[model samples]
Target: MSNVTTKKEVNVFIDYLARCEGETALRLNVDADGEVRHYEVKLFEPPRFFEGFLVGRKWYDAYEVCSRICGICSVPHVISGVEATEKAFDIKPGKQTVMLRKLANLSELNMNCIVRIYILGGPDFLGVNSVMDIAANPATLDVVKMALKLKRLGNDLTDFCTGRETHPVGIDVGRMLKLPDKHKIEPLLERLKEAKEDAWKVAEFVASLKVPAYKRRVPLLAIHREDGYALNYGKIKSTSGFEVTPYKHDEYISHKHVKQSNALFYSIGEGQSFMVGPIARVVLSFDQLSPDAQKMARKYWGGPEWFHENMPFSVYAAHAVEYMHTTDEMISILEKLKAGMDESEIMKEKAIPQKGQGFICTEAPRGLLYYTFKFDENGDVQFADIVTPTAHHVHNLEQDLKHLGPSLVGMSEKDATMQVELVARCYDLCCSCSVHCVTIKK
Candidate 1:
């Protein structure tokens, strides 16, 4: 047995994750022989306490308040809260409302994924320090231009429908509070159609980058919609062969408090850490993707093989595939809405809250997000539990680090540290959302 060495110990404190969303740090404990015996994925941001504060707020406010949890994921947060509240009140959104919300979410998904794949994760794969580095180089300058072009289209679509790109103000308890004018839908649709070439360019650029070779077999999970690619509604399905409606989440998912970090770690079954995000969704729902996207995925990563191999870095490629799907789906939805624009039907009536609990799952850009709420007859929230995608997979990230640490033993300190950061970036951890819940043990 090797003794724990106090001599020549290297304590690496990574204070800034250049591409990650919020305040986070990694503490690595490496022994004299360069073996990482212990590590802590530390989150420095103060807990947001969204659940605690939301308990007594009005049901209608859940959608608005929860959106503040994350700027990058506001659409999914708002949609999840609105859907869960509607379920609790026995309210069904009208067709127009559903279409509008779906449009906003898909647009936001594209916008968010573009940032992750091109700006945040791209620099790592290209052997550059940052996106600015890529932009500065004459050889890669065109790639940046294409990324911004596609990203702008996504932002314009999201803002056009929801009234704001970040914290959307258009969605309400049962329907959209505002709809895009009939005259403007055609122009927006035309713009979306025109951007198809740009979307393809960005996807091809990402496909060409080479990710580090590492594989760890972990269970994959995502929202499964049989009809098409799931954005807001679906059953929670896992590669482990179990599918359950979102209402059954409490029965299967569990969260625990770890002393190393402020974020709560989530697991399934008997303490098994599973993955939820772009890679999981792309692998599990390949057939459901748009036609061109599916064909491209087959060209690069084989059909069934992507699911069988649980490579964390493949998330970059998975995100590229999604970019294609979102553009096509957005165009289809806009065309449908243009054909039928009925104002009266959309604004019929909103339902009052009932005394019961509701639960829901929605696919955010990062992964599966779950929300459950208990409301009183007066439409006031009595209990609230919100789980972000980061909380769901932070434990899985740590597990990957544990397995990867041994192999990095003989590498240079700078090289080992960069390797660790690359793996963390693959998960695209949103530290802001994960720190929403924390327990202080006195």
Candidate 2:
């Protein structure tokens, strides 16, 4: 056979292999004028079993139970869940307690940012399969070294602030189990400054990548306040301008059941859709970023327009800005810390037997996380609903993939797969966080 005929047969064979291996494909049908007429992202469910284990647990224990939602994000889950409980009880943790909680959350954000950007996004941008590739690339080795330095800074700060890195044990019902001395906090603040600077440099490097020209106008959802992008608390708002408080989260949000997946499908308002997470935060609070972050953002991207339209390349730059912002916030709080508050000051009153509903909304590193719980007289969980940001953004990921596929229809299969993987990473879709995974078997 001629070369064209042989290549055509090979292509057909590879397509058959893809189908047999159960590889999920994004099929895009493009019209004569190069417009996308139809698109879909084929998603296959990966093995996950955590949501089922959460049913029937006491409200007080939900914090510990839901913490397992993701090993990387356990601290945020635990702290946010506990805060929701406190809100339901109408208890305000003392000033010192609140500050400590903020510190812990900031530490978690810093660590997560490092891992996602340097360890994950870095390799992908450089066309490498993993961090090891970056280490091996002579041109990218400095980037790898800087990422490691920043990661270490996050790990050390987390250990000092929360008493451990992977799973912190400092958070409690009303306060931290223990507090780091001023001496320890002082050095950590210095380390955070260094990490923030290094992260900014890496972000600049990411901005230089040649990203595909993909755009989508999906509505971005996040908590916004007059103050700025609320990290630990605020009202929920969307890119299309819908806004509500945490107490009314259910009114604007709803979940659907998808076959073959335990993950709940999320929708905003009346439409089956996606909401929350990093992209949403960047869209909602682009103006709130610090001057340094804003300058860097513009250097990488012209303005909010680049981020608002679902550009996957924006993830690295946005993550860097958030890391710097969170680091600065942590340092300010540590500087303001005062002595002389007894443990009793930070602890809440004895647990009372009463019916109560509590709601808490915080900016998890991934996106907007919400925890709501109704407790009975015995402090048992009568009703529990935890809406993770990852779950909220799944539909958006699907939508993006669907739109991207048709553009790659004529490309080589391997090139198409790379494009899809890049889109998936844009959402920073942590199947570990969403209790769902997407696998390309072929």
Candidate 3:
């Protein structure tokens, strides 16, 4: 064994609140070898901390407060939180409400995929510095155009359902503020059909890459529903064959501390590490995908080797499959609405608030997001806990880095750093989701 004590510190900076204002700071840190020897990940008090300040407030207040968790995913957070609160009070929205929520969630997923591919994954795939480079490339301009179309389609769908794309104003306690008539939603369905075709092309292209050879057998956790692959609600199932409802969520998951950062490290059942998100969900719910999606998965990822590897390309493939599935489902739902699903006629019931706990598990763009809220008799939030998928995978990212680092001992620092960053990006770690701040020190 080498006694060099090769220490590495990795720091990921997050400045959501600062950027929301005018001033921004990049938290930094140093990674010794591949280990986070010293680190800080900056978090602000405005949004997440503001949530903690919402104790003793009415249940509806959490919708606006937690919505600020990340500007990108605010809609899902708000809707999911609201839904959970409603469930706690034993209140259920009518048919139109359910349909609208589904539309919004699917729209958000579509937009998120576009952003991930164009802004993040594009540069990494093309070995370029940014999407602008890809856009300028004549050969890849079609891909760029497709990405833009998909993003616009998502925005249109959001507008059709919620009346605005970002920070929508339609959501409320009993029902949404807006209703979708045929004229409003038809154009969106048409656009989604086109977008779904384009997404398949993207998946085919990604599947053509020579995937890297790395496979670690870790427990996969996801939400499984009896009807189909659930995006909005389901029971949490593990690769080890253990399944539990969201109400028993705390029994299966827990978080801890690491030396280098304040962000909580996660483990399951006496150091049994696991992973969640796109890959896990796809693997566990493969049979639940739409027919088109199933065909595409087999077409692209049919080989036995594909099933054995933990390649990042699998994530892209799964994302594309998920996009297709959600789009198809949205179109079907829209067709139902056109066939006489009315928004105004459904009955609404008033719910009495008692001391209760609400639990929810939904698939965010990143993966499974679990939210738990404890409400007092007045329907005021007494306590809250959110378990994000990214948190569950951070330790695995570090482990991959550590394994890859020893092989790069003789290589130049630049080359080694690139390798590590690639691995980190593969996990799609949103340092913003973490509670700690990041800082790099020499």
Best by TM-score: 1
Would you list the C-alpha lDDT of every candidate in the order shown? Answer: 0.81, 0.67, 0.66
Candidate 1, poorest ten consecutive residues by summed lDDT? 1-10
- Model 2 earns a TM-score of 0.84
Q: Each model's TM-score, in the order given? A: 0.93, 0.84, 0.84
- Candidate 3, residues 33-85, lDDT tens digits: the string is 54433223322332345436767888877766766665666667778787777
How displaced is residue 257 in candidate 1, in Å? 2.9
Q: Which candidate is the best by lDDT?
A: 1
Off by over 4 Å in 1: 1-11, 32-36, 259-263, 307-310, 436-442
User: Comparing 2 and 3 by lDDT, which wins?
Assistant: 2
Candidate 1 vs 3: which has more TM-score: 1
Candidate 1, 219: how far from true, in Å? 0.6
lDDT of 2 at 334: 67
* Residue 293 lDDT in candidate 1: 86
Ranking by lDDT: 1, 2, 3
| Residue pairs whose backbone atoms clash in candidate 2 | 28-406, 277-367
Poorest 10 consecutive residues of model 2 by lDDT? 8-17
Model 3: weakest 10-residue lDDT segment is 17-26
